[model samples]
Target: MNLTYLPLFYDLSSREQRDALNELMARNPAIQLIDNILEQIQELVRVLFPSETIGEENLKQRVEVYLQNVDLATYGTWVYYPWLEKIVHLLNEEDFIRVRTSRNMYKIDQKEIATLGKKKIGVLGLSVGQSVALTLAMERTCGEIRLADFDHVELSNMNRLRCSITDLGINKAILAARQIAELDPYIKVRCYTDGATEDNLDDLLLVGGKLDLLVEECDGINMKILSRLKAKEFQIPVLMDTNDSGMLDMERFDLEPDRPILHGRLKVLEGLSSIAIAEQLRNLSFPEKIKYLSEMIGIENVSDAMKRSLPEMNKTIVGWPQLASSVMLGGAMITDVARRVLLGQLQSSGRFFVEFADLINDDPDKDFCRS
Candidate 1:
């Protein structure tokens, strides 16, 4: 497989060069804020390799030689795009390269924000959904994003949505689009000033050539239902990370042809009771969770029956202490799942909740109600 990856060993690789750059940034954080960042990266790459096809094993030695006496102020930024160069120049060099957990993680690298070239994401529900979108933007992950929302930003949303005083009264989708473009001019944004629905959901999910992922955080119960179905029908995994009183629901759906049915409409077609089956499926999961459901309903393979009934595979968080605690657990776990998905790791298809609170009492982090 042509692994779509930043070759880890590539140090005398981009990995090592990032470390050298990180060292410089560590010493001087407030470096021009925008242009200095890229300038430094270019400087490290040039100094380490000097030529494009330089030997891989010798990169570290060359980098160590270049840093014998380094000067950040003298670096130039002509190689990287002007917009990225400008944005990077504004940061304190040190702050830009700091890794979150350094002790165990083998590589301490400043991830090139996902949108260096161009990528798009279709996000629903601007409230918590906005959080996911902004987090992506802040990291400079995607190149383009299509934001859909029918609601306007209101005072209540200030509790969780990312917006400022000046952004009030604007439609949530448009507002989110503006935030993304503003944070990084390199980002090209499209807004669905209209709300999302089954009618237009197809256009949004299948549009823009490639939707890296679809994040569902919408409040409309039916729209939420449609979003998941469309994601499955389109073979796009859907990610829903939410916070309730204290727990976070992290659902994963990998559109599968081997499953039962994709959505309720099929059940309606089959003359099978969807509401009843959905209620049943919603309470079952893997054999274990299925067993848990069986214990409750007095039957085995409950979820398997539901899955056999449903026929598709797809993948898909939130909290409070009763909400706060779940929120923390959900938020934390979703990142783990997302990284796995982004990196092509194994993740089961279905709903998952990280009941963090159970840790103190000895219950495992696995608990479920399926559908």
Candidate 2:
């Protein structure tokens, strides 16, 4: 089933766009038409005057004033989502963004939002990366997001991935792009279905203006190392979440151009050229890859449950186990850190954990009123 995720925008004022819209409607007579432009304009009016508390009649008057008494049907742009066979009417880009992100005011501030709108973020894997990408879109954290993943959705992935059952067998990267488009069609998205590799690494990081930040989540040990090498070469910061124990890795290659990838954990790969590193890692047995992965992520820092689960892989279990809770937490953590990093509010490189297991007390006998 071929599908296109990008939404098409039309300005009816233009004769060309008007004909295109007419042709689209004629071609797909069953397409769903959704026009909520009036409500959208009402919300936009409230956003424009956030300090005031206006009644429903007053709000309607304000909306009319803002629209200059223009007819609501022709006031804004028409966006069509081909995948869903639906067309929606909403305020144009600038006003839509302002109203959509109105609640982020002061917390993100107008200046910071503008800055974020100019930033581009790259995500290499879709398992946990989907959460990060969607979070970034919902928060309007960045203007463009690049996704790369060669894998397809499977029933087993439902435990952690936020995708519908109908998406099974769909490329993960494409699935994420579709989701992002459905949420906010304005955010730009590019998918690398081949996944990040030695050949595409440079293009992914440098092609469309070097990525401001790279979130590396792919499972391949080689790509993990190679992607960072490319990011370091381009002086781009990297962020990663292991989807376990709330572990997050931030490599400020932008701030410290000389910093070793993964904090020098995989020293075996230090001296080899990118090609040699790929070849060498490609020949490693499954056990060897796991060994290197443990070293890279610090086996000592792994949670007790994960350490136990690792030994049962391909035996009692299929592969590494990940929970929905951990994946959600990872998404939140990475997005928060990403916003801070992009805004220049955070500048450091190291591993951090927001371990819920450590923060909560399970003891039933603890005092109730202690300070």
Top-TM-score structure, candidate number:
2
Models 1 onward score TM values of 0.52, 0.96
How much lDDT does each candidate structure score? 0.49, 0.89
In model 2, where do residues sit more than 4 Å from their true spots?
A: 363-371
Best by lDDT: 2
Off by over 4 Å in 1: 1-119, 245-255, 258-335, 360-371
Tens-digit lDDT string for candidate 1 (291-331): 43233222332233344432322321121112233333443
- Candidate 2 total steric clashes: 0
Residue 9 lDDT (model 1): 13
lDDT, model 1: 0.49
Q: Write the per-residue lDDT of candidate 2 for residues 274-343, one digit (tens) a residue.
A: 6787788776788998989998999878999998988898999996789989989898999999999999
